[model samples]
Target: MTDIPLSTWAAMAEIIGAGSIITGLLVVLFQIRQFRVQQRNAVAINLAQTFYSPDLAQALSLMQNVPDGISLAEIRARGPEYEQAAITVCTSFETMGLLVHEKIAPMGLVLDLAGGIVSTMSRKLARWQEDLREEQQQPSWGEWFEWLGDQARAIKHEQPPAHIRLDQGAGGS
Candidate 1:
């Protein structure tokens, strides 16, 4: 101990401090990388799950059969199946919109899955929503539906969807 001067102790302390700083920085970098990997995994899992949902498939089928610009009365006359299918589609899109808006899910991913149908249905159902809102005395009942449609529309501006090639073999377009 007598051989070591105060200067040596001070130098040792500085080296220790520098080492700690470097270690802390490394830990932070590692954590960031871990978070990104988790996010990618999350996106992959969600994509697979959502794509395989029976409700989504049923909804798409209903959308194809249901004519555009039909009134709520027509849907009611068509019976519960029609109403249920439309509601299921809207509800799914609404949840998707909320997820994207809240950053719980990536917008591009959600759009890739259902953007076209979501936008079309929102437009088709605008009148129904308006009437329903008036009946309930709440104007915000289906705001998320509109938001999702609007966001999808904005994306169209960046890169026109028509440019996206559809593969008939894959059942696209």
Candidate 2:
């Protein structure tokens, strides 16, 4: 076989090196995506455990006055033991738009679930409240109350009335 030219050998080496680097980068990206999915799952398990984890609730309660935005450091300050997990959970929650953060504190994190729930409930309650307002605007003694008499009868379905004694209260015919 003919000896390969030095330039050709060098070009082959470069191609091999570039291919390895690209392959390594793709592996790293895949690993990162897997890590994120695991982290999200962890957060979900932690959320479910919140019902039984008094510490979690206690820590979360500290966030009541956390203002419209906050940071991870603030969460860490609540309890040192859970700081790492808290930061991960908080960051995920923020990304999910479940919590809002005004300024990204160097270590800042804030849950925006309140914004979501409030907005949703506000719209729903507004409709209910509007119905209430419309009802109030009607003249007093609306037809709707006519159902009250039937409701009272249902409540008294069994036997004689408790308040009124038939033998004593009613005059014999």
Candidate 3:
């Protein structure tokens, strides 16, 4: 066989080097995507755990009886248990809000998981939350929770409910 020219060999070497670099970059990109998916999965699992916790379940059960637009004073008047229930619901949603804000959890996942509950609870607790901010002298109190509620409301308005979407044969709502 004839020997290859040095220039041709150099070109082939450059091509191989470039291919290797591209392959490395692709691997890195894939790894980054996988890491993000893993992170989201972890967040989802944590959220599910929180949702199923006894405290949250009890809080939700208690809050179901609370009327919309109930004031902080009204909650206090009911009993310590009512106040505790409100606090538990708020704190749980607050954590979820922070997670959504930080991109640790996707908004779509949150909306699908707890959109209606967030929307309803946010409305029910709006006055109480506002009063809490004033009483605590901290304007940022429950800010993320409010933000999350807003997101949930907006998505609720823009999209159909899961039952309707699912009936249409869509895999996800």
Candidate 2 at 24: error in angstroms? 1.0
**For candidate 1, what is the lDDT?**
0.77
Summarize candidate 2's per-residue lDDT along 1-173 as a digit string, tens digits: 56999899999999999999999999999999999777656654553453455653553444333443333344346566444433332333333332112222111111211223222222222332334337567432212221222222343444344345466555554
lDDT by residue (tens digit), candidate 1, 78-159: 8888778777777777787888888877888777777777778887776666766787898987788879988887785676
Each model's TM-score? 0.79, 0.34, 0.90
Of the candidates shown, which would achieve the greatest lDDT relative to the real structure?
3
Write down the lDDT of every candidate, Cα atoms only.
Answer: 0.77, 0.41, 0.90
**Ranked candidates (lDDT, high to low):** 3, 1, 2
Off by over 4 Å in 2: 54-173
Best by TM-score: 3
In angstroms, how far off is 10's CA in candidate 2?
0.5
Backbone clash numbers for all candidates listed: 0, 9, 0
Mark the 10 consecutive residues where model 1 has the least summed lDDT: 160-169
Error of 2 at 149 (Å): 38
For residue 155, what is the lDDT in candidate 3? 87
